[model samples]
Target: MRKTALLIAAAALLGSVSAQAAEQAIHIDRQPWSFAGPFGTYDRAQLQRGYRVYKEVCSTCHSMKLVAFRNLAQPGGPGFTEAQAKTVAAEYKINDGPNDKGEMFERAGRVTDYFPSPDPNEQAARARFNGSLPPDLSVIAKARGVESGVLRGILNMFTQYQEGGPDYIYAYLTGYGKPPAGEELTPTQHWNSVFPGHKTQMPPPLTDGQVEYTDGTPATVSQYARDVSAFLMWAAEPHLEARKRIGFQVMIFLIVLAGLAYYTKKKVWADLH
Candidate 1:
């Protein structure tokens, strides 16, 4: 009877501790994404819309340095045609090199050129944004870490929940709203519920009707967030589909080879047995 009471007391203590932790923890909302599971592929239209959001809104502060202009036309990516990509590239002026006069000059960007930085250097970027530098968006989606607790990890393994990056991006982008009544914000800080500690250096960048979507999708902030997040994910993992396909093929090959080996061994051992 004493041992049973002790076990019950321990259980109640654990329950109270868990309840307190839950009350103190920040909850990040998960967004629905197309490219989330093992067999997932990017939505081409959505990627294009995302690219538009990036070009019009996010590009003002963030540089996608890792992606070249030509990558837009690559297969299993944003599905931009060669002509379309070239047209897009022509919109930006790229720094080009030494001519007969051995002087650097500006030229229309080509497929070979990487996306240019808005600011000349880190110092300039920081100064422009009130001592807070805007991060390069090329891999920002991948850079954000997922808050996968023990229970979430087990659930994700079965659910194939690989949208942590994009989901976090979407949540964070849409998370900006009016602060709580008593919450005080510094002059340079903006309130974002999804952000760590609920404060961010960057202001809310997106608003309704910010970018005109060519495909007639709604220009709401929510849509913009989702599309841009998806685009960033594709930029970070351009070869994702190809990698998955190759991995699947390898698994199939191994299975077939194993079956053949098993049959051959059985045949060889039949006489000995």
Candidate 2:
């Protein structure tokens, strides 16, 4: 069986779909996303803001199944106080156990609990998204669409192309389609992407200065999206810091091992040669 990595952990929450604005599709104005050699790490401040953004903005319709509140205080994060985490955790609750009559009970979440999802399973997600499953964000950065490098998106026999790299994500988010003033939206072209490309369903989830990044990060719309995307990527893969550290240690040991092998080979070959 193919192993679909589902536990990577990630972000976003949806709201009432009825709240969407009129179908005004905007064109892709500029390239925005990049991944290769990206300099997108969320220092403590950015993560804190990103966390706030997720909770206040994106948590309604989506779910983050992998992260618990306690993870916030790790090596390179906001380090929320236990009291702070509990306050945040109490915002949601889950089924605790059963009553004598066999009904489920409820309790506020502790920092140790995973996030409560809006829906129970894929069927619920599809029902919520008009039949499209909202992809889990845990590993979305790595699960990047192949067309991520294309400036517009994958070659559509129908429309323009995507620019490659992180700009792909950047363009897609900002690319909400705007009708040409006169034309009404066709059902096919109805929903506008905040990013330029129509392939994305997410609206522009950021605003100028919506998030206060004390890390001196830019507060532009695109900058917020980029930072939050990076933040989500890191949350989905919290082991990355340890992974990087281990990789460095392994590489050093291999280098030393290689040097020893080379010297032994030279010593053995000296008499034979």
Each model's C-alpha lDDT? 0.88, 0.58
Per residue, candidate 2 scores C-alpha lDDT tens digits across 1-273 of 223333222111122222242143343343332212223234555567667666655666667887777776565456577788888888777787688888898988888888777788889888877776666655555555333223333444334222232344445554455655665654434444433343444545567877666668777776666655555656766655556567668979999999999999999999994
User: Which of the numbered candidates is closest to the native, going by highest lDDT?
Assistant: 1
Cα TM-score per model: 0.88, 0.65
Q: State candidate 1's TM-score.
A: 0.88
lDDT of 1 by residue, 85-200 (tens): 99999999988888899999999999888888888789998889988889998888889856766578799889978777888888899999888999999999999988988889
Scanning candidate 2 in windows of ten residues, the lowest lDDT window is 9-18
Candidate 2 wrongly placed segments (more than 4 Å): 1-42, 76-78, 81-83, 99-101, 120-125, 145-168, 179-199, 209-219
Q: Who wins the TM-score comparison?
A: 1
Q: List the residue pairs that clash in candidate 1.
A: none
